[model samples]
Target: MSRKGLGLLVVCLMALCQPLPSRAAGPLITPEEAALPPPKGAVGVDRRGVTRGPKIELVSGSDIASLPTRFQLKFQTFGGATVDLASVKVLYLRTPNVDLTERLKTFLQPAGIDMPDASLPPGEHMLRVDLKDSDGRAGSTSFILKVAR
Candidate 1:
């Protein structure tokens, strides 16, 4: 074959040998994905060590109509493990429909925790906690909270 014809043939063969483009594959599942199951054995306890079961409890004075609210959440877990907690997110949603995410952003800014801000108003709000561990293990929990004022 002539030089130009041989070059053209080589180019065609190379093109045919190339692999076809494919859609990006999904993310790989790591070992952590198999280890951390849904937050099993979840229980909320009060300061007095009283188990509240799997329910969100509001303090006596935690009326939605009140202002400047403060509350705490308590849970237990076995040792011999660690969590990054950097990916933890707390979403607060108020009833009757109001998104205070931005407001909560400012509230959490000083804390320096890289978490999603709440998008709810002052009232009975739902607290959604999403967490991913250092090994990529993931778990989530949610509870109702009264955001006073």
Candidate 2:
């Protein structure tokens, strides 16, 4: 082959060998975590005031999801109160109710959770997200994600 042609081939090969960008660094919910049994009191109670409180809304294409799926949530507040982003907490509704706040900190935002790519094991999984508003009124929401094998 000519030197020019060989160089071009080598460049193409190098580009092909480069690693592709990952959707997510790691699974949002590991297999073991998903396998855990439900906690004794896994129910999340809303502490929102009768008059007004913050609201959490799940915004996704479907409840049935696949691995590395887009997970988006929108927050709304009542009585002119704004969401207190720092008070956000995420819990995996399983035995002992796993705290996923730290793991999902990167995806949590002032608006709400906006994870472009979140991975979870197959089966049904539940998540409880809670947050407070500037007025100290609390709001919580439960989300069930069903994944296929």
Candidate 3:
């Protein structure tokens, strides 16, 4: 096999066999990230420690009124997969003139952490996040977050 192809195969094997580092051994979201409502759908964490991904779901109780003006949304991928933040595309639609894609990338790239929503409108929003790892592995999730006013 070509060196590049062989290398990818090695990566794939490592990804399948290796456990995530200790840092990722916890819940996808800590209790403090955002006050998520009860989990509505089934819960399972993928190789990336992502329990909520590949699809979108609003945090159960998050509504316009109770939605915090400030919050964090984190992203990660395991199985030896790493994403390029700039290449990590996002689509924040259904709201007025605002594109959060760049903002989200900015949030993850600097500290290598979650995206922060410090100031957001209180209403229903459709947010989509698509991540492609450096190895070409991809995962995405889209969900609605409603802020009650």
Q: Which candidate is the best by lDDT?
A: 2
TM-scores of all candidate predictions against the true structure: 0.35, 0.73, 0.48
How would the candidate models be sorted by TM-score, starting from the highest?
2, 3, 1
TM-score of 1: 0.35
For TM-score, candidate 1 versus 3, the one ahead is 3
Per-residue lDDT of model 1, residues 47-139, tens digit only: 333332222223222244433233333322223334443554555332222332343333232222222222224444344544444445555
Output the lDDT of residue 4, model 1. Answer: 100
Model 3 gets an lDDT of: 0.48
Q: List candidate 3 stretches off by more than 4 Å.
A: 1-68, 95-98, 110-117
Q: Please give the RMSD to the true structure for each candidate, in Å.
A: 16.3, 8.4, 15.0
> Per-residue alpha-carbon lDDT of model 2 for 25-144, expressed as tens digits?
357789999888976755435444465778888797446545678878898887778889889998889976788888777777778878887878888778888899999988888867
- Residue-level lDDT for 71 in candidate 1: 39
Alpha-carbon error at 77 in model 1, in Å?
Answer: 4.4
- Write one digit per residue (lDDT tens) for candidate 3, span 56-94: 222332444642343344555556555656656655543
